[model samples]
Target chain A: MTIPVIAQLDELRSTVAAWRADGQRIALVPTMGALHQGHLDLVRRAGELAERVVVSVFVNPTQFAPTEDFGRYPRDLERDYAALSGTAVSALYAPTAQDMYGPNFSTKISLEGPALGLESITRPHFFAGVALVVTKLFNRCAPDVALFGEKDYQQLKVISRMTKDLDLPVEIIGVPTTREADGLALSSRNVYLSEEERAVAPRLHMALQDLAQVVSRGDPIAAAVAQAREALAAAGFDVDYVEVRDAETLEAVEAHDRPLRVLAAAKLGTTRLIDNIAVPRA
Target chain B: MTIPVIAQLDELRSTVAAWRADGQRIALVPTMGALHQGHLDLVRRAGELAERVVVSVFVNPTQFAPTEDFGRYPRDLERDYAALSGTAVSALYAPTAQDMYGPNFSTKISLEGPALGLESITRPHFFAGVALVVTKLFNRCAPDVALFGEKDYQQLKVISRMTKDLDLPVEIIGVPTTREADGLALSSRNVYLSEEERAVAPRLHMALQDLAQVVSRGDPIAAAVAQAREALAAAGFDVDYVEVRDAETLEAVEAHDRPLRVLAAAKLGTTRLIDNIAVPRA
Candidate 1:
């Protein structure tokens, strides 16, 4: 578990190529350097999938809005390096802000799918930033596969599409959400919630669960969405959106042919949390 | 002098890797099919620069507009192979349209450059197509350096900017133009010209030469552009554009701080011709 820290771009390329030459399969775990348990699970899965795992800790500024928490975002690399010391990661590509973005940088990619709608509502240009940085990391790491957690369900779908669309020579292996003993999904933003805010956060999960049950009972797409909206309102959520859309197209479900997501975002006090549950059928 | 023809993308990757394993530096000469003397010059130069040269011939469709001749594009593999029979090109990657654009492929790149204005005037979506296909070829080949010709001046500049901006892991090398006996720039589209059209085509080059002579006298930028336009009109050309602008920024020049281009496009009857010359600062 000797995780080498790489800063320079060319040096990272040669090091990864050396790993490939040794016949060791490589996996990438991309992160924003706020190594909560949710992100740690992805690194663990990367270890399980390949002989060598690379944990990329880049807090991509392009992915955050000007009004967003890009400046105040937490970064404690020494603590993160220690948490992964006993795990499967072989390197930590902890590049600085300048290392990733220089003066000549100007390419901006427009991302599609769930991220577009979600980010558009709260943080404009958020998905473009995510798309640009993720593509950058993909080019940099050249990983055999990349591990992404389902906690960021929309993000996983968007990244999977980006990798496939661009013919990036890496597979995106999605890991399931890591959660507390309570039903709340584990996330770095969870730290910002107050005691009362934290207790009621599970209501998001409960609302999703209620919608999933209604969907299984053969309610139409509109009904399932309606039920979920009511549940969130009853729980005192400042509801952002509750959408029922085709899992594949990320568009409104015209006819219920495939998987659907009952997705929601809400603000409890000052913390904003998002979650989703796949409706197996509707 | 065995010019290896690699069909699959993976085979090209592995073969390049094997050559690198044996300590051979590789240079890539990427081209759209219909190889003329200009493309051959690129291949020859690649052979000179590195121990191994990989020439890729794919008529990338993404860069072609709906009205352009994509399906009807000429491909003379037998002729091309014969032309390079004695050259030291270690391999030739001539993939089918199927291999390059997979069945479900649907990603397109938009290159935001100063030449984007020309795209709207000439062949909207042309630069986007150029950027996407060229970037794809760069990723697939992963060469020590890639070669482009100065004939397509805007394209060379765009790709150079793209490589720098993206931090792509390859060096870009530019080769001077290879001209026909009549001093006409050799292009695949030259075949489309009628005998009379072909006779008048060299006048496009003549007009640029006259403009360069005027610019050499340190005439004001607008005055030199006006002179180029008059020369094109005198040569019986229906001019599309004739302007002098800074090379890198593509902005209209006030003074010569850098290289400037006297660029022109015209239609001699049904056949369109374009040419440019670098203005020598007096």
Candidate 2:
């Protein structure tokens, strides 16, 4: 059976309101909707956490810069609905851009701290866009809990920080990143990669794993990241950044005294791939 | 019959959750609490709208600049509780500054549209602070409806714009300004006036009223505002602004083509007072 799609705000509210009135717990999984296995797993986890799950499939325009691929971003709603069929998911909230953001809509949620560096350095407008849309989803859906993939580690952290600071009643849970057997972090944009780029993709994760091992055995973080960047460049990728920072705060760390996360982003042709792994205690 | 004061977030949430479980509709009245007749009226109206009413008395530090009156902002909880005693208000959420905004708190909700010009011109940091704190309050209390005094006219419009733009589930209701016989809008800062300054305070309101009258009778908005500014300056107010704007958008208006508002802000001694009135459409 196909899951129901709610397109209007009032309809979505009434639906959630009815479920809430029945004393059912609601969980939300906000997605830009090119549902892959990773997203499916998030839905499964959401079902386990709550009685009903709302999967929001909005391709938020504000998060994408004009030069970015927002225009070509993959959208296949029928395919998505087919993928979610028979799953524990209850509804798909796919509000059109016009419906989601009316003509005069002008509020924005911005953050500091964890949102300051990393992805922000490349896409300064990205997290603000994510924060705004996620906030709107949270308010509209009124979920008891919301789930996100840790594949976009910084995005997860940013959302977590904003939710807590705003005192939003919902709990934000980050599910572990799902990856291909060869270890490429699953991403919607992966479809954009050519066969040659796809063949070279798994090296991004491999380099991080190798870097994590050396750092775990007490290699200096800076030098380890430098090596990772060089290795990715040698593998025919354009490296954006390779840096180790405090895992929790995402603040700059010169040494590995505390729990740390080594994050890296690189481009294989036009597709940017970002991945991070915890540095084992040295 | 002293009303209960809930200072901790956990306490506030549990109380609200219990009320929701009972299927009781909730309303909120957010105040900085030197509870004047204006705030009491908001609480009274909130009770008329919803079954249970929560009055949040947070003197949010972020809304005040260092040069402003944050330190001197009147806070008397016992008196506030005493004032709420006979009203329909159920609880006072007067969380401490530390509890409301922790050491690492770093998220803000800012806006354009209605939040531009007007109060934002003199108190540039003010509305951003108001937006953040109110968003936090709305999420924490999880109200079905929230009430504000129209005395802070620009603030009422700004909050209305934000609540709609962000898709916050709570309905924002504006209560008419509680006023003195001479038309001075009641505010917590009204107590800051000395005997002589008190005599000059109502001129701010009278000036807006006069401006509104002329603009409704076909005077050009610019000429009327300029005359109001001169009248206010002559009456011992170091004038901040006297302008006519679109009532809904708070955007500048030159002609009487739409619903108009006459707004003015001026300082009598150290007390900054602001007031507005409709332009009584031609």
Candidate 3:
């Protein structure tokens, strides 16, 4: 049964808390509500893991840069509802921007990291906004386990770091990145790509796949990364960053840490997509 | 028999949780472990509120500024144990800095307010540190209610703000500032003062009390604040700031909107002290 979307804070708590007391274990999938395969994957996983799944579909305005695609970002509820019609998602908390951000809502948690190097440089305050809003969502939803897609690899890593470091009693589970048969990483931003740019976007995945193959073959660190950089350039993609870091810590590989992730972000036309794969253990 | 000083996290949890489960309501009073009468008042208040009380004696290095007296701060376990010996306190946790701050400690929460504006001018990262460490303590202690002293009025307000904003499941009870008979606010820092400085230390309280009196007489806010500043100067105390702010919001008030707090901070030689009063509702 689709519980109606709750917009107000007080109503949301009372409504959810009532459900909680009735022995329903909640699973929350926090998203910005441009529902795609990536979002559905999260919803389906939450459905699998919990008795009642709640998907908070509010597009947090603070997470967007003034110059980023906050206002212009595509949003359609009827279409999204159509997508998750038969899924385990019990309700959608599609609150307005005003309801989520109160007049006195100013304080935010900020995280600095080795994973946040170049990605942070381009989108300063991006992770801070992401961390804070996710934190608020955790407080509101009170889920036992949260499901996230590794497509936004750093974000999943950041959530894990924040959860453990703060001693918040929630388990973070990362599902593999969903991708098109042709290999473009599944993203809500893919809507912005034109036909030609969309055609070339799969080069991102191919480059990352090549890097994973090299690292698996026990190639020297610098050489494997360089080969992937060359492939991205040859594929006509505007590369944002590519780093091979320890999967758990997100710390840059100093002397060949096992279970590394070869991560990449590249722009095709107006859209940016990221992809990552684990470097197999020796 | 006195409760043992628990250093292990797991040991402390079972000891406290068992007491709580037996229908003994629990209260926590967190301290930095020098254990003065001010801290004892908080423990005493906790005892009054609940059947079981836990006193956490962690100096909280995260709350201390890097250049501040984190290393030099007083710590006396033998004396602290002797002090809490005869109290109704059920448990004492004295986790080390390394235990609290493990291998990749990163997440920090910031509390918002003009309450933050109090000491933020001199110590920029102070409230962020305070908010982060207190949140950590709450997670570990998991008390039904926590006791704090309003002597560090801004710190108490910030902790309460974070608790409410985050929907943390703990009641915050602010006890009135405990002071010496001579009116000097009791603090571990009082040990740093020479006898001459200690003699004038009570002037900080006198100045705040004078402002409280002026506001009571219906004087203009600016005039009452100015008179308090003059009082501090006449007592040879180096005045840091004197102002009126909303009792709840901590926002500046030129005119009374709600009950206001007349607050002052000053230095007598090397000792810095702060005091505040809830101005009678106008």
Candidate 4:
């Protein structure tokens, strides 16, 4: 059965209120439509954690710079609905931009910690937009738990940090990144890749794996990063960054005294791809 | 009986959860704890709106600048407890600074519209600090509705705008400012007034009254504001600002096509006081 799509803010609240009245726990999976296997996996995991699950599909314009793909970001509500039809998802909250942000909307949420570098360096306004919209979703949905895919590792950390810092009473659970058989992480934006670019996309994940392995063996961090960047460049990718950092804080790591993460962001033709892997403690 | 003062985040959440489970609607009255009749009035109004009302007495340091009175801000928990003893207040959420903002608290909420000028022009860090801490309190308390006194008229407008802009679930209700018989707006900072300063303070409110009267009767706004400023200065106060603004947006008004407010801030000796009056339509 297809899940009900609530477009009105009042309707969403009433639906949540009704579910809450019945003592049902709720989980939220926030997305920007154009569903993929990864999003489906989030909905499924949301069901495991909650009796009622709400999936929000809002292509937040603020998260995208004017030069970025705000206009080109694929949005298919019907396809998203079809993707989650068989899942235990309770509702699909798809508020229009006007409903989400009305006239004279002048409030913004900015962060300084985990949202500092990574995607922010390339897309300066990215995390602030993410933080504001995610906060709005958390407030509107009033969920007990919210699921975010680890495919966007930096975003997951930023949201977790914002949730804790703001005292938002919701548990942020990061699901393991879903991947295709070829190992490229499943993403809605993956469709932007041309046929040739799609074939070469798996190399980003491969580079992260290689970087993680070398860092785990106590190899020089700079050398591991250089190798990843070189491999991406050889594969016709324009590398943005490849580095090893403390997993929790996303700060630069030299000794790996704590858990470490190897992250990479690079562009395959016009499509940007990012991937990360945990560096095992030596 | 005195209300329970919850200082821990988890305890506050559990308290809210228990109230929710009991099907109780909650209201919040946030203050800085030198509780006067104005704050008590907010708590009383909060009870009228919801079955349970949580009063948060936090002297939030973030809202004060280094040069401001953060270190000496009035905080009397025992006195505050006594003040709310016979009131309908359910819980007192007085989380410590360390609990409210942890070691790595890096998130901030900033506004552009209502928080642009007036008090913000003088205390640039003030509203941002208030915005962040209030957002945190709203998240932790999860109140169904929150009340703020109009004594801090700009702050009430700012919080109202923020709640709408951010889609925060709580409804913001503005309570009328409570005043002494002599008509000085009740404030925690009023405690800083000396005997001579206290006698002269009522003139600020009188100036706002006079400004509103002239503007309401079709006097030129600039002329009316100048008169109010001169009157404040003549009354031995250092005038900060005296102007008419759109009540809803807090923007300067050329024509009184909408509701208008006349506001003034002046310092008598070391004590800075602010007051506003509504301009009745002609």
User: Least lDDT summed over 10 consecutive residues: which range in candidate 2 chain B?
Assistant: B97-106
User: Which residue pairs in candidate 3 collide?
Assistant: none
Which structure is stronger by TM-score: 1 or 2? Answer: 2
lDDT value, residue B40 of candidate 1: 85
What is the DockQ ranking, best to worst?
Answer: 4, 2, 3, 1
- Candidate 1 lDDT at A207 equals 87
Clashing pairs in 1: none
Q: For each candidate, what is the lDDT?
A: 0.78, 0.91, 0.80, 0.91
Docking level of model 2: high
Show the colliding residue pairs in model 4: none
- Model 3 C-alpha lDDT per residue in residues A1-282, reported as the tens digit of each score: 565777676776777777776767788888877788888888888888889888888777777889999888888877877777888888787777665566666467877554367467678877888887787787667777888899888888888888777666567989888889998778888889898988888888888888888887778878878778888978887788888888877888856647788888887766777788887676
Pitting candidate 1 against candidate 3, the one with the higher DockQ is 3
Candidate 4, position B74, lDDT: 84
The top-ranked prediction according to DockQ is 4
lDDT of 1 by residue, B1-282 (tens): 467888898898899989888878889888886888898899889988899898888888878888878878888887778877877678889877777776545445555656455434787777767777777777777788999988887778778877766666678998888888878998888998888778878888887887888777876767777777787787778889887767776666777668887777787875677767788777
Better of 3 and 4 by TM-score: 4
Return whichever of 2 and 3 wins on lDDT: 2
TM-score (0 to 1) of chain B for each candidate: 0.93, 0.98, 0.95, 0.98
